[model samples]
Target: MTAVLPATLAAVDLDRTLIYSAAAAGDTAGLEVVEFLDGAPLSHATPASWELLAELAGRALLVPVTTRTVAQYERVRLPVVPRYALCGNGGVLLADGVRDPGWDDWAAGVAGRAAPLPELLGLLGAVAGQPWVRTVRAAEDLFCYLVAHARDAIPAGWLADTAAAASAAGATLSVQGRKVYLVPAGLSKAAGLLRLRRLLAGEGPAPRLLCAGDSLLDAPMLLAADAAVRPAHGELHEQGWTGARVAVTAATGAAAGEEIVRWLIARA
Candidate 1:
């Protein structure tokens, strides 16, 4: 068995952090399929990332903290199976591939204080039939999102107004490329990471928290980490976000994923 790092917890994001879709993955050469949809490859990893991740998983408690739902996350076949994972922006947690009921309860409590899910969903109902939007759906019933085909085609001022409305409703809005996420204000990846920390508290000394991501939603988790990293591109990079403890990768796209895994391994 790969020797494990008992005092290092690496909470990493998947998409654009360690995995990438064809459109987001800059160079396809030396890429390996990590996710599939309908029997076709949908997401991929750099050859170097795939190799480094195996080592990182061995050196730390690598928990994937992603906005993907549990069902969607299961589609990714990583080099190692993480014992703990946070999905749906911390709306769901999984242990050994099974959904954790207590985590669900915690998520419910967080969501309860926000606008009702249906109300949040209703806020985006108008986009369902808009030509710019490709899909409009609720995620794990804790959040909603809209996939857009053309960013410029989105009606002007609608996003800002919607974001403001979401804020007023105790919800938050984030735009990541084609997807726009509307999540409960307090339901964050950082919160899930904290819960994991609490669950692991008495097992041993507190592990050092390391994180990586490339999105605004990931900001909280990254900030909460002892040290974090973000790629040179993506939502956060586009906005020029940086933190005292967060490092920015020199590479972008698939190569950046490789760099991130390497960072975790080096730090761990």
Candidate 2:
């Protein structure tokens, strides 16, 4: 018989990983910011997903990790269940609606080393003039990102240039779906999770960490997990997934999220 695994924690990406963004491949009716499906056909989540998440919520801590700023995340208005949340790419941490002070300390420490927003904005300004970029905007938190027309719209070298510039400034940049983001190198989802682990798990041997996402930006958190899951689509899937335990899911939105929860709950 196989050895049984210990209890585990599930760290999930909010946007593409759990909830579907309002912007569908062919549909742009509600792409103002980001939209979530409550019960529509193109909705990113389904009833099954809610049931599964509720189950996991009971068994393991379900952390909603997203790049959206704390205020932006508030606009999401997800079903209010008690769960820890990390918003603004780990810039702010909240537990059951209250801001956690420790996370602010961690954010300050990370920001102290990251490149300033001015430098990144300058590069983005140059890139914005390119024909490929339709619109660019800064998050309420001051991070920069752009809505590009397509992958081929911008020269591949532009991504390289941005990465190089970000590197020089000690920052990190990534493009996911139609949007690109400039995040401080040290303020990553993995780092935020580690801080939570330290607070909750303490010095005891770490419990298995289960994570899932769909972008290269998610690679660090996925790699750090004891087991990880990904959908058949997304940047990570296109490049091929090769590390850690993985659950390959269907390409559809809610279906993929349901599959991830199923896989994690089964393992737990």
Candidate 3:
């Protein structure tokens, strides 16, 4: 008789990790469109990645953990539909494309422990007055983010000041690519993933957790996982963020997405 291995749970970030936008998709010739807006191509993944993702999904429970809003995440069409998704930086949970009311109630309780959105928005308003600030928008009514004309043009001191303010208000500030995020301290991707893991475990044995991401927002999730992987590009890599169990892919761009999928299948 052969020993049976326990099931595995894989949580993955979408943007710049498993998928890439046109600007980030190097050598787009063979890339397949994964997202579209108004019939215009928005994001893509390599064909090889799609095939590997399907295989990985079959081998383990795959959950998309992203900072994107529910509406934004819905735009993405993956080869395999995840049974659960963590969106809005863990502010919202979706089960089979529908919002989970229990998760909503839990998020409300968590939100009570953090500074109000209005206060954060006020701070963002002040920062938006700067010439380098392009636009500021709220996400899922849970957090706020700012787009800069040029990330380099934004003063380092200003970012530091914003971070301090957010910290004082029980929130965290993160800059990824050209966007600045003001996330409430109580909400995190790890929390959402853990909750989902518990729910899944109730159905069977607890699965080993594997995560992959490419940004600072994903740090908590990666840290919480049994094993994690990251691409060579994105905010986390630029910051030199690493951990004992975290492995980095050799390639960048869409190729990195494929590499991550292949790694997940092998690990599973």
lDDT of 1 by residue, 52-141 (tens): 888988888889999998889999998888888899998898888889888898899998899999999988887688778898899998
Tens digits of per-residue lDDT, candidate 3, 1-268, equal 0122248889999999999987777878899999999999999999999989999989987889999999999999999888778999887989888998888888877766778998988778897878899999988888899989877887898889999999999998988777899988888898888877777677566789999999888998999999999999988999899999999999999999999999999999
TM-score of each: 0.95, 0.83, 0.93
lDDT of 3: 0.88
RMSD of candidate 3 to true structure, Å: 3.2
Give the alpha carbon lDDT tens digit for every residue of 22-53 in model 2. 44322334322234345343334655666677
The 10 consecutive residues of candidate 3 with the worst lDDT sum are 1-10
Candidate 1 has what TM-score? Answer: 0.95
Q: lDDT of each prediction vs. the true structure?
A: 0.88, 0.72, 0.88
TM accuracy, model 2:
0.83
User: TM-score: which candidate is best?
Assistant: 1
Better of 2 and 3 by lDDT: 3
Minimal lDDT window, size 10, model 2: 25-34
Rank all candidate structures by their TM-score, best first, as comma-separated numbers: 1, 3, 2
Q: Could you tell me how far off, in angstroms, the CA of residue 135 lies in candidate 3 after the best superposition?
A: 1.8
